[model samples]
Target: MLSNRQLLVLQVIIDEFIHTAQPIGSRAISKKDEVSFSSATIRNEMADLEEMGFIEKTHSSSGRVPSEKGYRFYVDHLLSPFRLSNTDVDIISDAFAKGMIEFEQVVQKSAKVLSDLTNYTSIILGPEVFDTKLKQLQIISLSNQTAVAILVTNTGHVEHRSFSVPANIQSSDLEKLVNILNDRLVGVPIVQLHEKLSDELTHLLHKYTSDFDAAYHYLKGALFDQQSVQLYVGGKTNILMQPEFKDVEKIRSLYSIIEQEEEMAELLRSNKDGMNIMIGHENKIDAMQDCSLITATYSLGDQQMGTIALLGPTRMEYSRVISLVNMLSKQLTNTFHSWY
Candidate 1:
């Protein structure tokens, strides 16, 4: 166990290293004046810290940097709950108030804004399709043989897919079909109720033998689109600016993984509810070995929600990001209430 003074020294060193992104020396802590410890004492404590894997000496410079273990310990033990100012709240609130903002747009803007504020590459994960609520689902016939399935969320965002139908079906019949589906499924989470629809389908729409197959296929497609959470990443260019990612090979591999929509969609799909934090090596993806994700669920109730996650380097300021993500999700639920 580290002594009280030693622990305090570790905290100070980590804070100083985070700000400067450089190895700190005993003389530096000694010169702080505020630290109150003599250079010899601080140096001894730092040496003990290094032996315990909390800090590392990189060269003959007599300076040290916080090891990954040190960062982990600091985050878990030393960090306190962060408090935001009215100004901070207002900044996030304005991002929510932008009119008719599609979920994708909101997510993209958030990443851009966060990266701009923090000077780090940022990521935001959109709502997962599994938790998407069935707010406004409409079937509009484009031709006798095709129709469009347009869906609107309580968030005023819309998404649609074109579905081909039997030519024998009438527009009136399609409208009736849509009404039946909407009446039985509206406000219900599509994914939760999706798999149980087998028994309910043939019996419910037995009237239209010519249309049953097309309807089932269309509805099935809608229900299983669980990978629908669109991710919006910004500041890929900015990641290139970070000294840690300066290695060209590291940058190439990292960018490749981030650019893969399938992998990102899979990440959001797994966050079923509530806030989740994944630190280094905690994530399943090998490519994400050096990154961390701070995520929260925005739910109307227990049944429906979307995930909002921030992706950044593993050395991210977790306290601030966690607070920001939590507050942003709360605002999302509050803003969506009026539409519901």
Candidate 2:
């Protein structure tokens, strides 16, 4: 447990480091209006805090910076309530006020706005398809030998793939296949689509068409072969603006990890509902060990739909970012709820 004076000193050091990204000295804390101690007295408290492993001095500087443990303590105990400014509220409100109705459009705009607000990379994982039921399926013919299969979810997300039509499969077979799929698969959750097709729909397809095997294989390849998660990353270049990521090799490594959508999506999905804060080494990814990840879940009705996250250096503006993430998550949830 920290004494009141030590806590105040630690808080000041972290707040200063967050904004300036520089080590803080006791003299700086003494000069603050809320601080009533002399530099000498503040220095004593800082020494005690450092001895307790709350702060450390860089090799090049005598000034102290918060350690990862210090940051965790600050977030858990010392953070003050951060109220959003009118401008901040307006920025978020105006985004949703754009009258957009589609889930992808709303989420895309939210991701871009979040990145612009924090000047950090924002990654949003679209709702998992497992809970989304099929709204429609269409096979549009592009030519005599090629066609596109489009899948539409209840959330208005569309996935389409083009494949070569087998010579043995006629256009009439395609029509019958789509009609049967729509009739049987509509309203079925996407996660169950494959099993449902294998058990129930396959026999029906064979009864309707002589070339069932060829048509079934083609349709499966087009629709279910790769059901990758939908990931939207905004302001990918914003990491370049952070001083901590100035090293070319570090930036490259981090960018490479972010580009792997599966890894990032899985990382975000690991968080439970509500807000989660992972500081520095708490992050499991090697490239993110020097960073902090703040994640919040947005929901549709009672179920969680997706995650909104901000990635920044460990010297992140935690209070402000937490407030922003919380507000945005609620906004996203409310928007989705309005649709239902």
Tens digit per residue, CA lDDT, model 2, 1-340: 8988888899899999999988898878888998998899998998998899999989988899999999999999999899999999999999999999778899999999999999999999988766788899999989999999888888878887888988999899899999999999999888888888889998889998779889888877777766768899989999999988999999999999999999999999998888999999999999999999999999876764799999989989999999999999999999988987
Top candidate when judged by TM-score against the true structure: 2
CA lDDT of each prediction against the hidden true structure: 0.72, 0.90
- The TM-score of predicted model 2 comes to 0.96
| lDDT, model 2 | 0.90
RMSD of each: 3.5, 1.4
Clashes of each: 0, 0
Quote the positional error of residue 57 for candidate 1 in Å. Answer: 1.9
lDDT of model 1 at position 16: 85
Model 2: colliding residue pairs: none
What local lDDT does model 2 show for residue 183?
96
Off by over 4 Å in 1: 59-61, 99-108, 140-147, 155-157, 163-176, 192-204, 209-215, 218-227, 265-277
